[model samples]
Target: MSTHTSPAAGPDAPAQPQGGRHAAGPGRAGRDGGLGGVARRVSLGRPGDPRWARPGLWGVLALAAVLYVWALGRNGHANEYYAAAILSGTRSWKAFFFGALDAGSFITVDKPPLALWVMGLPARIFGFGTWSMLLPQAAAGVAAVAVLHSAVRRAMPGGYGHAAALVAALAMTLTPITVAINRDNNPDTLLVLLLVLAAWFCQEAVRTGRMRALVVSAVLVGLAFNTKMLQAYLVLPAFAPLYLVMAPGTSLRRLGHLLAAGAALVVSSAWWMVIVDLWPASDRPYVGGSTDNSVRDLVIGYNGLGRIFGSGGGRGGGGMGFGGEAGAWRLFNDIMAGQISWLLPFAVIALVAGLALTARGPLRDTRIALLLWGGWLAVHYVVFSFSSGTFHPYYSTAMAPAVAALTGLGGVLGWRAYRRSRAWSWVLPAGIAVTGAWAFTVLRRSTDFVPWLAWTVAAITVTAVAGLLLARLGPRLRLRVAAVALAAGLAAGLAGPAAYALTPLGSAVNGTNPTAGPAGSGGFGGMRGGFPGGAREGGPEGDGGPPGGTPGQNSQQGTTGDAVPGARYGLPADGVRGGGPDGAMDQQMIEYLRRNLDGATWLVAVSGAQGASSVILSTGLPVIAMGGFTGSDPAMTVDRLDGLVSSGRLRYVMTGGGQGGPDGGGSQVTEWVRANCAAVKASEYGGSTDRSLYRCG
Candidate 1:
C-alpha cells in the first residue's frame, strides 16, 4: 500500500500560479481557512469542492461501515456486560448494581450509564437483539476514522491532507481490534472514538485558541468518563506539552481554558457519583468476580484508585488495579504490542530525529507536538505500571489516536528523509521489502493456515510501505485512488486473520486469546460485559430467586446458556410454567413496573410512607431500592431503601420468596416478598408444568 503522491494542483490553487507565483509556504499552506481564502487555496475555480470532495470522506466512511458489517458476519455474540445489562434492565429491571432486591447478576465492575442506555434502548424496541448494539459501535468506528482523516489532513499539508486522512481511515477500517470491538458489544470503541475527538479538539484548541474548542475538549473528556472512566483521562496530558511547547505564549489565557475544562469535567461526572455514594453497601451485587463494592468503592476505589493502583483488577470483577495475577502483567504488555507495535520503536526514533532536525522553526512546533503524544502514552503506561492498577487490553485504545497520528507523522518524515538522499536508496525500498515479508506473513495467517488476530502490524507494515511508495509518486498522479485502494487491501488483509481467529460474537473467545473470557460465564472475568443473563439479566434485585435468600448461585458453574429462571410480570418466566400464585403476583407487579421506564432514560425512585409502591411495581420502572412500608411499622426499612432508591442508589426488593429477611422475616422467599415482594407475577423455577411465582406488596 505504499505510495508517494502529490496531486496536480488545481489551476486556482494558491500553490499554483494565479498567473505564475506560488501563493503559500510549505508548513502553513493548508493551515489557514476563511471563505475567500479557502476558495483561493482549494481552487474553487477548479475541480474539487465540498460536493465532490465530501464523497471521498463519505466513501471512506461507507467503506468503514461495510467493513464493520462484514466483521459482523463473523460477529455473533457480544460481551456479557451488555447482555446482562439488557436482560436485567429489560427483564428483571434492577436499577442498582448489587441491589439484589429481586435477584442480581452483575457485580464488582463500575461503569457509567451511557453504555447501558445504548443497549437498553434497542432491547426495549426490537427486544434484546444483536445488530442494534453492534451497529452503534460500528458508527463509533466510522466517526473515529473520519475524524482521524480530518486530523491528518489538518496536520500535514499538500494534497497530503486527503492522502493522510484516506490512509488513516483505511488503516483504521481494517484494524482487527477496532473491527472486533465495533462488531462486538463493548465500550472501548466509544472510548477510542471519544479519544479521537478529544485529540482533534485539542489540536483545534491550540490552533484557534477558541474557548469552544476548550469546552468541547471538556465535553469529550466527560463523554469518555460516561463511556468508561479514568481510563480515558489519559487524553488531557497527552497534548498538554503539545500546546505548551508547540504553541508557546499560551499562559495567562490558558488559566481560563483550564477552568472551563475542569468545569466540564465536574458537570459531567458528578451526577452519577453523588447517587452512587448514597447507596447502602449490602444492597449491591457482585458478579464476574466483581465483589459488591460500595458507591464510594465504585467511584474512588474500583473506578479511581483501582485504575491507578489496583482496587478491582483481579480474577474477580476487579477494576484495572485490584492485585492482578502474574499472567496479568503479560496482558498489559500484550495489549500495548497489540495496539501499536509498529510504532513504538519507530516513534522513539522519529521523536529523536524530529527533535534533532528542528532548528526552532515550525518544525520545532510540529516535532514537539509529535513527541508529546508519545510522551503522554509512555508516562501513562509507566505510571500505571508502578501502581497495582488494573489494565484492560481495550484501555490501549486510549493510546491509539496519539500513537497512530505520531506513527503517521513518523512515516511521512521517514519517506521525506529517504527522498532527500539517493545514498539511502536501498534503505527505503529495503524496509518496504521487509514490510512485504510481513504482508505475506499476514496473508498466510489470513488464509487460516495458522491463527486469527493476524497482528495488525502485518497490515500496518504494508501501509507503511504503501505510504512510502505513495510519497514517491510526487505531485502529479492521482495517488488518492491508489492510496485508498491500498488502504482497503491492507484492511482486507488484516480482517482475514481476525475474522478466522475470532469466535462467533456470542461464542467463547478463541483459546489463544488472552483477553477472551474464560470458557464458562462464571470464570469469564476478562470478557467484556462479563455479567450474567446478558444485559438486564437478573440483577441482585431483579433475580427472583428464593426469597430472603441471596440470588441463587449458579451451582452449575462454568457454563453459558444455562438459562437462570427469570422472574416476570407479564412474560412467562422464561421456561417455568404455572409459577406459584405468589410468583404470578410478582409477574403482575413486573408488568406494572415495565410501563414506566423509558428505555434510554435514567431515574431515581423512592417509596412513599404507606409503602404503597404499586407505582414502582405497576410501572416496571428501574427503581433504586429504598426503605418503605410506613404507619410507624418498626420493620419498614422501605423508608431507608426508598431514600436510597430515590437517590438512584438502590435497586429492588424481595418478598414472599422467603422469611429470614426483615424483623418479621419469613423464609428467604417471605423475606424476599417483604423486601421486594410486590404483588406481581414472577417465577424462578418449577416442576414440569407446575412452576412457582412470588408476590410482594
Candidate 2:
C-alpha cells in the first residue's frame, strides 16, 4: 500500500489504481464513437466501498422477507383475537373515507386507522385468510429497516451506518415480540412505525436544520401520538439529545418548524379524539386495555405509562411482566439478555473490544450512532424495568435497533482494526471460520442436531467467546473477520422462519367464494374457507377466519368500508363474497337468532378482538354485552342473563374457534348456563375456530 502514485494516477485520480497493466488499450476514449472507445473508472461511492445501501440492506431485506413469510406461515392457529383486526373495512363509501379520517371507531381502541387501512388493502383484495392479515405489519417491518439504514448512515460516524442499520433491522425484525405484533393486527405495529418515522424526520431536522424536516418530524410525531398517544411522544426526548447536539444554529427557525410539526400531529391525531371527546365519557374506553378504552387512553396513558414505569404491579395487568425470574434491575438484565439472547456468548466481549480499540476516523459516526441507538434501547428498558406496575417484553421493542447497531458496529470496527494490524491476517480467516461456526451453532436451527445440540451450542459458545477475545488482541483483521462471520451466522439463523413462510399456502379461502385465491385466501400455507375449523380472521385476505365472534373474512364486514353508494364498501374482490350478510354467516346468524328469541334483545357475552365482527355476524338482534371479556373469552352472565335463556329472550351464546385450545376448557359461563338452563339448539359455524351456536341452556 504505497502513498505515492504513478504519473497516470495523478492528483484528481481515482484514488486507487485502475485496471491491470493491460491498460485501456486501443480506442478507449471518453468521446470515442465505438463501444471499445468508452473509458470510465469504476466508481466506489463510499470511497473503496461501492455498495449503497450495503450488502446488509439486501441481506436484511431477504432475511426480513423470509422471516416475514415464515411468521406469516405460522400466522394464527386456532386463535382469532388479534387475527381478526385485519378484516375491518369502511362500512359504506362515506365511512371508508370518513373511517380513514375517523380514528376508526369500529376497530379496537389504542391507535389510529392508517396502519389498519394499509393492512386492510391486501386482505380486502386477496380475500380474508389466516396469513393475509399479517401483510401490513410485514410491510411496516421492511420500511422500518430502510428508514433506520438512512438515519444511522447520515447521522452517525465511522461508516458503521451499514452495520448499525443491518443489526437494528435484524433485532427489530427478528424479535419475538415483533413477531407477535406483526402476526396480530393490534396497534403496536403502527405505533412503532410512526415512532421510527418521527425519528427519521428528527434525524433530517437535526442534520440539515431544515424547517421543513422539523415540521415533517413534528407532524409524524403527532401522527404517532394520534396512533398511540404518548407512546409516540417518547420519540422526541429519547432521540433529541444527539439531534440537538448536532444542530446547525437557527434556533428561532427551528422553533417554528417544531411548532408546525406539532400542529400537524395534533390535528391529525385529533380526528378521533375530537369525536371520542364529544361522545359521553362512559361510552369511551378510557380505562381498559383494548376493549373498554378509547384509542387515546390506551395509547397516551396505558401504553405510555407502561413504557415509562411498567404496568406490572397493577397496571391493570396481572401476568408476568418480563416473563422471567426477576424485577427492577434484575428484570432489565432479563430484557437485555432476551434482546441480545442470540449474541449472549459474545456481546460483552465484542463491546469491550469495540470500545478499548479504535478504527479509522471514518468510523467515528458509526460508533457514536451505535452507542446512541444502544442507549436509546437501554433507556427504554430501564424505564420499563422500574415501572410501578406490570409490563410486557414487547414494550422493549423500541430498543431493538440499538442492539443490532452495536453488534454491527463491533463487527465492522473489529475488522477495520484487524486490517490496520497486518500481523495476524492468517488468524483472521481462521478465527472467522471458527467464530462463524460457533455463531451458526447458536443461531442455526437444525432438527438434525437434536441430541448433541445443547452440548454443541454450549461448547461452541465457549470456544466462540474465546475466539472473539483472542481475535480482539490478536489482530484487528481477525476481530473483524470474527465479527463479520458472527453477523452472517446470526443472519443465517433467520432462514428457517423465512423458508417456512415462502412455502405455498393451502385453501384458506373458498375458491367458490371468488376472493379466496389458489392455495387459500391468504399467504403461503393458508387454508381456504378459513382455518380447518373456521375461526375468526382478518378481512378480505383472511383465509376464512372472521373478526369478532369468529366467522371468516366476511365477519369483519360492517366495520370496514365507507357509507357511500359505490365506494368499495360492498364490492368484493374478483371472486370474493360481498362484504355484507347478503349471503354470509352474519346474515344467517342474525336470521337464526332472530327466530330463536322472540325478545328484541339478547345478552351476548363475546370475547375476541373484533366485537364489531360479531355485530355484523349477529345482525338485527340487540346483542347486549353480558360481560366485557377479551381475547376469545367465552364466559357469559348466566347468573344475570340466565333469565334471558330461560324466558327464551336471550336465545343463544356463541363460542369462538381458536378461542382456547381444545374447546377452551375453562369457560365457566358456558358451563354455568348449560347446568342452569336448558339448551334448545346448536348450530355449526363456518370458517370458525370454535363453536358458534348455543340456542340456550
Candidate 3:
C-alpha cells in the first residue's frame, strides 16, 4: 500500500498488487516484452498498470477546472454581497479583517472573514476583477475534487479504488449546486474544501496512528469553523468518534490525544471570534447581522442557533419553502431536491447497506469510510432538513462531498458483496430502483425546469431496472449485465444535475440568496435576479420581489407597501438596463455620489448592502450598509446615525424598502433620518426612486 494508505487498506497490505493476470508465473515481468506479455497486462487499473493512476486523477481535476473556471467571469462578481466585501477588503486591512461590506468599514458582512481573506489575496494581486474575486472558489473546487479522490484512493481496495475515486470526484463535480457555488463567489466552496481536507487528514491519522495527523485534522475543522462559524462543526459528531474508535492509542493516551485536539479546536476557532469581540464595538464595523452589535450574538444567535431554531430577523429569514414553510420535508422539497438531493436516495441506501454489511467486522477500513462519510451526510441532513432559518437550496453545497463519497464507496462495496454472496445481490438492484424512482419524483416537481428530463429519467430508470434483473441469466451474464446496470445507474443519477449545471446562471445571481436548477435565462438557460442587494435593473435581481422595490429585495412577511408582500424575494429584470420601474438607477447616480460628499467619513448611509453595495462598487466610496443583509440587522440606532450626522462623518442617507424603511420593521434610524434629514428630490438623480437619497444637515 502507499505510505498514506488509509486504515481501510489493512496494515499488512503490500505496496503493489500481489498477483494478477500479470503474475505470469514465477519472475516474468508484467511488461516482459512482446505482444503476449503486453496483452496480459492490458487491463483497466491492472496491478502493473503504472500509466493511468496519476493521469486519471489529473484528468478529473482538469475536467473540474473546465467546469468551474472556464467562462467563470460570466458570473461577474457573483454574489455581489461577497464581491463587494472582497472589493473593500482589498483596499483596507481593517475592512479585510472585519469582512466589511463597503470600503469605509461601516458594517461587516454577516459571516466571518476567512473566505473573504482567501478571495482577497487574488483580488489584491489581480486588482479585484470578476476573475480575481472568483478564481479562489474555482481553484478550491478543483482541489476538493482532487482531495476527495485522494481520500477514496487511500481507503478503497486497489484495483477498483481508482475507479471509485474518479467516479466520486466526477459525481461531486457534476453536482449542480456544487458547480453553481464554485463558479460563483459563495463561501460554501471554501467550507466544503476544508471539510474534505479534514476528512483526508483524519483518515490518514487513523491509518498511521499519528498524533500529528490527528491534530492537523482538528485544526482544519477549527479553521473551517472560522470559515463558516458553527456550521463547520456539523461533522464533529462523526469526526470525533472516528478518531476515538480508530486511532491507535491506549485508554489514557487516547483520552489525552482527544482532549489535546479539542483544545486546539477551541484555540484556533475561538481566537478570531475573541479578537473581534474584544476589538471594542466602537473601533470596528458594527456586527452586520447581529441584533445586539456583538459578533458573538452574530455567531451564537444569527449564524449559529438561528440557523437551527429560526430566530433573529435577517440571518433567520424563515423557511426555504416557496410557500414560506420550513417543514421537515424541506430537504426533499421541490425547490431544494433538484439542487442537491438527486443522489440522496442512493447515498442513503449505500450508507445503510455498507454499515450493516460491515457492522460485525473488525474495525476495518470500509467500516471507517462508511462512518466518516455517512456521519457527515447524516449530521448535515438533519440540520438542513429541520432547520427553520434562512436555509437556501445552495446551502446544500456542503452536503455534496459526503453524498458523492458515500455513493462511490458504497456502490463499489455493495457490488463486491453482491458478487461474493447471493443474498447481497439484492442490494445493488434495490439501490438503483429506489434512486431512479426518487429521481423521477424530484425531476417531476418542476417540469418547466427541464422539459425533457422527465422522459429521459423514465427511460433510464426502466433500463437500469431491467439490466439489474437481467443479471440473473447466469454467472457469465451476471457480471456483464451488472456492469451495464451500474453504468446506467450512474448515468441516470448524473443526467438531471448535469443538464442544470451545463447552463450558466449569469450575473444576476449575485446576492445573499441564489438558487440553481435546470432553468431559464439571464445569461441564457439560467434563472435571473436574486434578492436583497443592488443588482442590475431588469436582470436576475428584479425577478421575485414587488415591482419597483429595492434592487436586492426580500419576500419576508409584514413588510408594508409592496405589490407582492411575501411573494418570494427579488424580481427578475427583462435584461434591459435602465428599462422600467424595476430597473436600478444608472451609473450617473454613482458618479453624483462620488463627485460630491467630500471629506465625509461615509459618503452615504443606506438601508442595506443591497442599496449601498452598488454605490460602493461604482465609486469606491464609503457607503455604510446600515443594516447588514436584507436591511434587517439593528446594527445602527437613531443615536448612532445622529452622532454620525452631528459629527459630519455622514452627509447623505438613502432609505426606502430596507429594514426600517416605510415598512416600519427596520431600526428607528431611517425614521430619525426622515424626521431630520432633507430628502433629495428624485429628479436630481434622474427620477430614480428605488433609493431616495437625503442630505443630512
Candidate 4:
C-alpha cells in the first residue's frame, strides 16, 4: 500500500520550522513528533490514532508466532546432526557450552556453542521433547518479525514508513525457507533475530549520533558472531560505513566512536573464543572440524575462507566444492531459486530507485537504512553465488531480512517518488516487470514443479504494467493504480516460494549441507544421500555412500553388500514424525544397545557422529563419536580403545563406513574387533545389515 504524503512531509523531506528558518537536517524529526515520537506514544490503549494500527501490528505478530510455534514438535529433531547436540547439551552444562554430542565431552559440535546453549535452557526445564528443544527457534522467529518492523519504522518515518515495516515483517514471516528453518532446531533463527537487533540499534545510533547505541549494535553483531562465526561479519561492512557516513558527528569523532565500537565487537565476538582457547585442552573435548585442536583454526579455516575458496587441505569438511559439476548458476538454478531469491530482483530495483531519488539531498536516515540493508544483501549475494565451498539453500535464510527490508521500505518511497514525477512512475513498473520476468525464468526450469506459477506471474506483470501506464493519464485513479501495482508485484514475488513452502521440503531438509525446495530441484537432481540418483548424504565427516557403496545408493546400502533395514539416523526423506521415536535410527537399535550394554561406561563407539548420535539421543547414554562428525578426526586411537575395553570401561564397538569418517584407519578396528570380540548378530538388532555390535573381550 503506497501512501502519498506531500513532498514536504515525506520521510526523506528536510525538516522545516513553522516560523521562518529551514531546519538544518533530516534526522531531527522527533522533536515535532517524528517516527520516534509516534512510536513512543503508541500503546495497548491506543496502538494507533486510526485504532487498527496497534491491533494490526500485534495481530501480525501473534499470527507469526502461531505459524512458527504451532505443532513445531512435529519436526522431531529436524536436522539430526544438530538434534543430537541439543540432546547432549540438555544433559550437561559442559556439553552445552562445548557443543558436545554427549555428556562425557568427547568431541564438540563443528560450530560454536552459543546457539545450542540458548536451545538447551528450555529443553532442560521442559525435558527434551521436540517442542521444548525447538521453542527457542520459534520464539526467535516471532521476535525477529517484530524487531524488523521496528527497524524499518525507525529508518523510514511516517504512516507510509509504518506500512513498509508491516510489509517487510509479513514477507519475512511467510518466507518459505525462513518459516522452515524457524520451525526446526536450526541456529539460523537466533542469527536472524540478533542481526535484526543490530540493525535497529544502528538505526538508533544514526538518529541520535550517540556512541552508546553504536556500541550496542556492535555488541549484538558480536553475539551473532558467537552464534555463527564468520557469517555474522557479513553485515559489518555495510553497518560500520553507514554509521560513519550518516552520523552527525565530525569525521574524527565518528572515526573514534567506530574504533571504540570495533573494539566492542572484537571483545564480544571473541570472548567465548578466548575462554574456550585458554581453557585446558585436556579438560574440554577436542574441537571437532579443526586439524589442530584449536577453535581459532576452525574459524579461520573450515568455517572461514575455506567456505569461500574450497578447502586447500583435507582435514576440514571442505569438499570438492559447491555446485559440484553444476557450475555457478547453482543458487539461481531450479533447485534453489524459489526457496529464497524470489524477491531479489525487486529489491535491487527498489534500492536503485530509492537511493537515486534520495541521493541528491543530504543523506537521510532512510538512505542510510537502504545502504545498510542493500550492502548487506549485495555482499552475501556475491558470496553465495560464487563460493566454492559447501553450501545449502537453507543458508539463504540469512539473506531474507535484507531482501524484505529493502523491498518494503524502498517500495513505499519509490511509489511516493513515482507520484511526484511521471518519469519515476516507470521505475515501479520496471522493477515489477524484471522481478516477474526473472521469476518466470527460474520457475520454468522446474516447470512441472509449480505448473501455474509462470503464467500467473506473466498475467500479473501485464496487468500491473498496464495499470501503472494508465495512471499516468489522470490523477484521480493514482491510488487505485498504485494498489494494483503493489498487489500484482507482491503476487509475482510470493507465488513460487509459497508453492515450495507447501511441500514436505521443510522437514525433508536434512544432512550436514541441506538444501530446501522440491527434492530433485537441487543440483544433483534429487535428495542427497537418501533419495534416488543423488549423492549419498554424509555428515561433517566425509562424502559419498558408506565405503564400497554406490554413489547414488540410499543409506540402506551397507558396506557388506547387504541392505541396512532402518532409515539412516539423520537422512530421513519423509516429513518428521510427531512424538514417540521418530528419526533415522530405528527404535529397536536403540533398545538393543540399551539392553545389552548395562553398567558400561560407554554404550558403544560408533564410526561417526551420525551413528553415535542416533543411539545417544535415544538412550541418553554416553556414546563416543570416533573420528567426530565426518569421521576423519583422530578423536580416539585403537590404543585408547584397547585400554578402555581391557579396563571394562567400554564393552561394545559398532562399525560402519561413514562419509568423511575415519575409514582410513582401515579394517584394523573392525578387523581387530571381529577377530577378538564376540559378534552380535543382525537378528538380535532386527533387519539392518549396517548394524554389527561386538562384545569387546
Q: Quantify all predictions' global Cα lDDT against the true fold.
A: 0.44, 0.44, 0.69, 0.69
The per-residue C-alpha lDDT of model 2 at residue 652 equals 58
Model 2, residue 464: distance off in Å is 5.3
| Alpha-carbon runs more than 4 Å astray in model 2 | 1-56, 71-79, 82-112, 155-173, 250-265, 268-271, 279-301, 306-315, 318-322, 325-340, 344-364, 388-390, 418-697
lDDT of 3 by residue, 1-697 (tens): 1222224664224335445542436557535558865554443334443345556666777878987776554444467678778878877889999899977787899888999999888777756666666778889999999899889867765545666677788889888778777877778999999999999988887776777877888899999988889999998898888888877877667768888889989888888888888897888888877877777887788788887887655365544343134666766765677677788888989989888877775437767888899999999988888787767667888999999998887777777666666788788878878877887777776567567786787788789878876776676767777777778887887887776666543334434444566442111223533211213333322222221212122212214443431122233221111111242445445456556777787877766676566555544556777766756676777877888889888888766542443213334665687789887765676644545567886
Ranking by lDDT: 3, 4, 1, 2
In angstroms, what RMSD does candidate 3 have relative to the true structure?
8.1
Looking at candidate 2, the ten consecutive residues that score lowest on lDDT are 509-518
TM-score of 2: 0.61
Every model's TM-score: 0.59, 0.61, 0.83, 0.83
Per-residue lDDT of 290 in model 1 = 23
- Among all windows of 10 consecutive residues in model 1, the one with the lowest summed lDDT is 547-556
Number of clashes found in candidate 1 = 159
Give the per-residue Cα lDDT of candidate 4 at 326: 31
Clash count for each candidate, listed in order shown: 159, 106, 24, 13
